[model samples]
Target: MARAFIGLGSNLAQPAAQIQAALHAMTQLADTQLIAQSSLYGSKPMGPQDQPDYVNAVVALQTSLTPHQLLDALQRIELEHGRVRKAERWGPRTLDLDILLFDDLQFSDERLTIPHYGMRQREFVIYPLLEIAPQLVLPDGTPLSDLQHTCDVNGLIRLSAQ
Candidate 1:
């Protein structure tokens, strides 16, 4: 099985519940086993300040599914949770799931990107990631520890685990 990390977030429709529900759904994915999961964190929206703050967390999974297969499953989870794709980038949504890493591999396609495009700089992603994988090394050889000092938590607050 390939080990992977997925970042989850929501800022609409009772976001904490949305995140909790997504976690449950992930555990049910065929050929997948939920591994470690971080406690939820609350943070400001990455795009327009007008949107509500988001609740975020990261989860580790061991799965037999290929990367695209995993992405397809994750997108299905988002849609099941009422996600909508909009032209507006980072607009508020009921759920957002991204493939942050997959067994130290690096590749990108129209449908997915490994290491996620912008994870290093996002406090919401960084802290929760750190909580679960303290010794993680990026596909580029950067230590996850090295990112902690540089990325400001920026009012990011840890919430209780569900």
Candidate 2:
């Protein structure tokens, strides 16, 4: 099974409950196992100041499913949790599940991107990921630890221990 990292976020509804519920749902995925997950974090919205701060976390999964298959499964999970699509980028949502990294795979297409397109610059993604995988190195050989100092925690705060 390839180990993959999935990022979860929510700023709408009861976000912490949404995060925990998503964690449970992940364990039910066929051919997938939720190995580890980080604590909930509160962060300012990436796109607009008008929305509520988001609760975010990262999960590690060992899955036999391919990247695209995993993406499809994650999307399904999001939909089940009441996610809604919008034309506005970074608009608030009930759930946002992203494929942050899939083994050592480096890939992208119209549907998805691995080593997620924006992970490097987002403190909400970087900090929690460090908590779960401190020694992680991206597929391109960039050490995850090296980026921690680059992204300030100015707007990010740990909301829970687990």
Candidate 3:
């Protein structure tokens, strides 16, 4: 099984409810085990900053799915939660699920990339990931703490978890 980490966030209507629903939906996937989850963190949107701040969390999973298959699953969950690609980059989203890491796999294609390219730079991603797995190492041997300290994002506030 590939040990994968997924980033989850929602900023539209019923933000917290939407995040909970997405986590519940993920637990129902076949051959996937929800191993650990970080507490929800509220943060300002990364870009196009005129919208709502997002509630973000990370889930660690043990899954039999390959990278692309996992991406497909995440996309399906987003669609089920009323996610639309019509908005501008970093616009308010009902549900935003991103695959942050897929074990040691390094993949690049027309559609997706593993070890999510932007994760290390976003405290919204690094902070919660540190809470769950602070010692996790990248393929290039970079410790998560090393990455977290270097990230410039601030204002991450942990919220109540269900």
RMSD list, candidates in order: 0.9, 0.7, 1.2
Ranking by TM-score: 2, 1, 3
Q: Is candidate 1 or candidate 3 better by TM-score?
A: 1
Flag regions of model 1 displaced more than 4 Å. Answer: none
Candidate 2 residue spans exceeding 4 A from truth: none
Q: Write the per-residue lDDT of candidate 1 for residues 1-162, one digit (tens) a residue.
A: 999999999999999999999999999999999999999999999879999999999999999999999999999999999999999998999999999999988998888889899999999999999999999999899999999999998999998864
Give TM-scores for every candidate, taking all chains together and pairing residue i with residue i.
0.98, 0.98, 0.96
On the 0 to 100 scale, the lDDT of residue 13 in model 2 is 91
Per-residue accuracy of model 3 over 5-76 as CA lDDT, tens digit each: 999999998898899999999999888999999999999888887889899999999999888888899899
Model 2 agreement with the true structure over 1-162: per-residue lDDT tens digits: 999999999999999999999999999999999998999999999878899999999999999999999989989989999999989999999999999999999998999888899999999999999999999999999999999989888679999997
Measured on C-alpha atoms, candidate 1 has an lDDT of 0.95
Per-candidate count of clashing residue pairs (backbone under 3 Å): 0, 0, 0
Cα lDDT for residue 39, candidate 2: 91
Q: After superposition, how far is residue 39 of candidate 1 from its true place, in Å?
A: 0.4
Candidate 1 vs candidate 2: which has greater TM-score?
2
